[model samples]
Target: MVERLTRAVLAAPRTVLVGALALLVLFGLYGGGVASHLLSGGFEDPHAESAQATKILEDEYQRGGIPVIFKIDAPNRDVTADPVVGRVGKQLVEDLKQYDFIQDPVLSIWTDPVAARNLISKDKSSTLVVVPLDGGEDAAPGHAEDLAERFGGERDGVRITPTGQGKVFADTNTQVSKDLFLAEAIAIPISFIALVIIFGGVIAALLPLAVGIFSIVGTLALLRVFALFADVSIFTMNLATAMGLALAIDYTLLIITRYREEVAGGLTREAAIHRAMATSGRTVTFSAITVGLSLSGLLLFPQYFLRSFAYAGLAVVVVALLGSLVITPALLKVLGDRIDALDLRKPVRRALGRPERGFVPTEQTWWYRFVQWVLRRAAPVMLITTVVLLILGAPFLSIKLGFPDDRILPTSHASRVAMNEIRDDYERKLGGEVTIVITGSTDAAVDDYAARLSKVADVDAVTSPDALFVDGRAAAPRKSEDRHGEYRILTVTSNTDPLQDSGKTLLANLREVAKPDADVKFTGTAAATEDTVASIYRHLPWVLLWVAVTTFILLFLFTGSVVLPLKALVLNLLSLSATFGAIVWIFQDGHFGALGTTATGFITATMPILMFCVAFGLSMDYEVFLLGRIREEWLKSGKTRADSDHAVAFGLANTGRVITAAALLMAIVFAAMMASQVSFMRMFGFGLTIAVLMDATLIRMLLVPAFMRLAGRANWWAPAPLRKLHDKIGLSES
Candidate 1:
């Protein structure tokens, strides 16, 4: 089937090229407009209790719109009592009321003194004025930006700074978009240079870049299509561009290298293209499938943040595979001998009068020598590599997970600065507060429940309409009006940061405390974090199962060797464990503070899962590249133990340079994301770079050869029934 498809593409190169060009133009148009449809936040599980509570609070209780807070400071004066401050505050309130998006009766120091006590800063020089907007969280950013432009400045001896969730969201989106463009600008040129050095020809170098561009454009188009049915996170754009370019470069290197070798072996152009398609093309197809399956695990998580990556990854992999298998072969067939015509390095070699070295199996290459050394002392090499991998992975056991917050943004950002101030100054009221909604209960029952909640360890205070409870006792009559009909709301405040260990313990205690005759639901920052973590773990096992089962099946078909697939799985995991350890060390433990990042002492909960899928799939990709060449050599030689050793050395000699070059290009691409101001992206960039480097060098070069030598003929063993099944349906170039 692959040969027939290659023949058809080769038979109509011009037609295929034209059709691909048209599709590229169409997708480019669609991709250009995708940013407007993307979402800024998706950290919470949509079906979790916090999500349900948030929805009820918004729809049923009319608790909509994020607060646009203005911190007004007047030096050396009580802002609440100063004539100039009072006049300005009232005028600000009246002006806010005039805007249609602003909710009626904006809360300020002059409007309500009881609430104002919490809003006022401790020094009595500054107070907060909050204006609620008309829309949900998504609309808050735009509204906040507009309001900040109009009202965020000095007036009547008071200086106002606008800061809230909406403004933070807007700033983060803008920063990510900028970072994405910067990453592309840096990665593409570096990749091209690396490709040039690897291929030693300008035309050969540009082919992979062209495939990369096509993959990115097509993936963006697919993302736009998916956005019509579901919310896609803006972060997905970053992942899409990086994966598209990396995979395109990887697939193109394998295909073009094979085609060049076949041509140099005196095969006709058509036959070379056919053989290349039959082998490298088939491998590229299965590699993309394996990658797509790995990313599909993200779809099982409830957060759009994870699902968005799934959408972006699968789209890019599919598009990259098509570019490699179909369009690339067609281009190769058309280019023929001219593919080597643009050899910029040829002049230098000619000046030195050195013979050109083509990619053929030889004993003199460093890859062959290295494999021979490993085979000679296979046991010691394997043991040392295993110990190193395990030590690097040890830090992951101490990793602490948390949800992202304003801290994800750069410290210089206005929203981040404002949020830091709020967290420091308003610790009692705003920070670490748990909101509980109780339905189908009487007001007395709700009050009693609030009292019980206040008794929980670490609870500072509990506020309800009926009474204010402190240390499980009624301290004062609550002056706030009842905002309940069939349900009541209670606020539980604590001293610990909600995203930390103490806060998690407090949440558990709150859940453990009993409430009578009410359906109690908790929603707030800490509660939401707990729920999101729970949701991810609940579905993580299924995702791992799916990836494991599908990857094994695909590898079995690709290699017709059961043992090889298991070995690949173990090696990939070892490489990933080292990467995870590096992440925990640098990002979580703050060991690399000189790298210009602030460590929060905790890793983002979603990052490990996302990184595992991406890095593991990429490792599997390189695995297939090496195994395909070894299998080809094994088939050509006799299937004896000596033949297996010969095949290992021969395959490494032929393909090891290509694997290292591809891995270097991929690492460079991911490393460029380290320039991102966001901490998560930096961690992602660093972790992936380490994973690629380790896989390409240690695992592929040293461990794989040694393991193959040890396994001997058993490397190709399979059950009789499975062997028959594989022979009937296996994919092979021969």
Candidate 2:
């Protein structure tokens, strides 16, 4: 198959090259244009949900625009009718109007009057003003920052602080943008270096990133076209670009690495390229299926965040596979022997200039020797590694997952500043507290039950329009008094950190409180956070289980041995776990904080699980690539397990360096994402880097051989029934 592909590509190298170039160019142009469009204008402010809601609220009530709470502080938390305080407050409102982001700031006590009780704080020091948003739906604080600066950082005699739903959205948009871009930029260069080390040739090294970049840019174009028809969030685009780059580099590396190996094995350049396409291309096809299927499970959760993410991820992966499987093979055909140009000229050349012929046992083979020594000490090493991994993974046992927060930022960010500021100023309002909702029953007993809740504490004030008021946050509105009546609402606040407690205590309390009331349902911020975590966990088993099954089926067909498929699964899992643990330790467990973010005990709510399914599937990709070589050797040697192991070992030793290089490259690409200020992305970069290192080092080098040695005769198992089926339908390298 490879030979055929090689022949065709070589027959028209220029044509093949040109065609691939054209495809890449098309996407580049389209993506650039689309990206330019987005940059030129702006997407509607999804963050300003609250600000938008305020306007709607005002319109409904026939009142004014949403009121902005002005926090006026004297040296102390004093609110008074002090002449200076009143003058500062009045001047502040007037000065705020001069800033365009501030629609209109009314100063007089008349509009928000003392009778209206618009004085939010006890000391007549602070007051609320009604302000309309100045721009269209896209208006944000980022656009207003310059204007604010122009008017002087402080307004009037008062320090200007903006807090509300609109401000929150503007803040979220700014921070998310910084974090994601930082990670994306960092990922590319690091990944490229890793690739260079793997391929030993700049051309081979650059290929994966090249393919990834093209696909990424092209995907943007594709999505732009898609965007014309459906509503796609800008956030989705960020995620898709990331996934595309990572996978493109990944899929490309898989295919190109295989192609180079085939070339080194002495196949004609064309044959090598063709064979690589036939096999590596097939691996990509399966890989894409596995990734797509795994992501599908996210849809069941019903959050647009995850739902849109699923679609974007699936699309990019598909795009990545197409670029590697189709476009890469053609390029390989064109490159032919030139693929080895650098190896022959540089390190290989330097080593070959000696009488030893530059052929020395690789570190993998050397590590195999170390393993032999370790086998004598295997019990201790195994026990020690196991203990450490357990200790590393233990944080997950107490892991607390919760809704997103500013802690994920670098703390220097405005988002973090704003979050901290709000938390401090409004502990009374329980600002940023998750909303607790009991939806099941609207029975009058609900009010009596609610009274039970207000008494349990963490209830700053509770108001039930029909029900009695106990303390917690402001008066609870009747779920029935409005459409919200069918749903009773409870506002809960805790001094304890929600993410750290894992939100379990609050959830438990809510459940316990609702138990006596029949048909009780509780939902709120803490509830939502807990539910999302539970939702991830609930779906994880199926996702990983299906991934394993899919991998086994694909490997079984790819390699006619039931034993091989099973081996890949076990070995792959070990690699994944070790990698995950290492990352957890480094990023989540606080092993290294000076360089970047410390892990948040629990990684971003969904990433560890996502990495598991995707990374494991990807690890299977490299596993199959090299395993195929070993399998061929076994079959050729008349099923002698030892001979096959040697062949496998030799193949691994020969290819081991490149595998490590590729892993390093991909790790670099992933690590570059670490530059992102966002904690989720930062953790992702760290975790991915660790996973690649584990696969390329421990699993591929040591564990694979050790496991293969253990499997011995059984390692080549092809059951009679399956063997017969294999004979009928299997695709063999031989």
Candidate 3:
């Protein structure tokens, strides 16, 4: 099949190249504006109670609870009765009222003084203005940015800065865009130089870049299509470009190197293309399938933020695979022999007074010697490697998971700074109110429910339509926004940090306080966090099962051996566990202060699951590359234990340089993400870089070879029925 495809491609290389160029242009034009269509918030499960309650609040109550909450500071400590403060505050509220998008009667010290007191800071120098915007959730961030541009900063006697969930989302999206550009600027040039050095020819190096560009642009266009039907996050852009470039380079390098080897072995150009496509091209197909299946595990989760990654990941894998199999082979056929033009390795060797080495004998290569040393003491190598990986992964045992917040941004960010001040000096933190809507309940029942909510530990106040309840007592008649439709609304405010354990516990206790059969719903930061975590836990098992089962079957089909698949799964998990542990230590436990962000004491819940899928697929990508060569060598040599060992050494000696170079190049691309200001991006960048390096060196170099050596002939063993099944349907070169 591969030979036929190669012939078809070789027969019409120009037509293939022209068609590819046209598609690239079309994809570029359509995908250029994809970032604008992506959503800023997708962290909530739409089926959860919080989401349902939020929809009710939006649709039934006509209330956009909070706009961009602004922190206003005055020169005088006493805000009330201060002439300048009152004038500036009232003028700002009036300015806000002019915009129809903002909800009427913006609260300030002067307008609705009763509610404004709750918003006043403890020091009396600062107060918050609550201006609710009518725009829906998708447009809230844009509205916040517009408000910030017009009404934020100094006005008359006070300084106002926008700070809330809306503002935070806007700032985060902006940062993500900046980080994506920066990561690319840093990664691409370095990658090209490394590729040139690794491929040792300018023409060969350019092929990877061609494939990378094709994959990224194509995926971006595909993501735009996805955004039409689903809520795709802006964060997907970062992963799309990163993975697209990495995978493009990976598949291209593997195929091109195999072509060069076949050419050097006295094969004709067409035969070389056919053979390379049959072996390395098959590897690319299996690699894409494994990576795509691993990413598909994310679909089980309800959050679009997580699901969006799956979309981007799958798009990149598919697009890169297509480019590698279709466009790359066509380009290789046209550039045969000339692919070695503009030779760089020979010049470097000449300058260094070293002789030109075309291809070193396999027995004398460094990888061969290294493999021999490892196989001689395989038991100790495997034992020591496993122990080291386990030790690195120990910190993950204590990991705490939670939703992201303003803290995910850098400390100097305005949103985070405002939040810090609010947490420190305000009696009631802004946007920390848990709103409950109860249907089919009488006013008396609601009053009692409000009193119960006010009695919970750490509860600051619970304001219902009737009165404000504080510590189970009716403090005063409160004219609030809680009265809407036939449903009774209760707003519960507390000082607990909503992204912390205390916040989640408070939400749980509130839910428990509600009657078992009552038609009650909760919506707030804490409620959303609780629901999202629960959703992850509920769907987590299915994701793991899908990844494990599909990956096992694919590997089994590829290797025609049950033992190799099991070993690959175990090694990949071990490598990923260590990566998670390192992430916990650095991002969660706050061990690395140099990353320029404070530890939140909890890792973002979606990160671990996302990382596991991405890293595991990448691990298998390398595994397929190594094992394909090993299996090829094994089939030709004797079927004895010594022959198996010889095959392992020969495969390693042949493919070790490509794998190492590919790993380094991939690591460089991800390492550039360490420059991101957002803590999660930095953690992702650092964690994946560590994972790739460890897998390439520790697991692939040490553990895999050691295990294969120890297993000897057993590594290729399979049951009679399964062997026959594999012979019929397996993906192999021979």
lDDT of model 3 at position 385? 94
The runs of at least 3 residues in candidate 3 whose Cα sits more than 4 Å from the true structure, single-residue gaps closed, are 64-66, 103-105, 479-481, 514-517
In terms of lDDT, model 3 sits at 0.87
- Measured with C-alpha atoms, the lDDT of residue 726 in candidate 1 is 93
For residues 348-434, write the lDDT of model 1, one tens digit per residue. Answer: 799999887655447888888989999999999999999999999999889888888878888898778877777776634454778
* Candidate 2 segments whose C-alpha is farther than 4 A from its true place: 1-12, 32-153, 163-172, 175-204, 222-267, 279-301, 307-309, 335-388, 425-429, 432-446, 466-468, 471-507, 514-521, 579-591, 594-603
Quality of model 2 by C-alpha lDDT: 0.58
**Candidate achieving the largest TM-score:** 3
Question: Order the candidates by lDDT, highest first — what do you get?
Answer: 3, 1, 2
lDDT of 3 at 488: 75
lDDT of 1 at 542: 96
Q: What lDDT does the true structure give each of the candidates? A: 0.85, 0.58, 0.87
The runs of at least 3 residues in candidate 1 whose Cα sits more than 4 Å from the true structure, single-residue gaps closed, are 64-67, 75-77, 98-107, 131-137, 351-355, 358-360, 425-429, 479-483
Candidate 1's displacement at residue 711, Å, is 1.3
Q: Point out the worst 10-residue segment of candidate 3 by lDDT.
A: 58-67
Task: Indicate whether candidate 1 or candidate 2 has the larger lDDT.
Answer: 1
Per-model TM-score, in order, reads: 0.95, 0.77, 0.96
Candidate 1 TM-score, C-alpha based: 0.95
10 residues in a row with least lDDT, candidate 1: 422-431
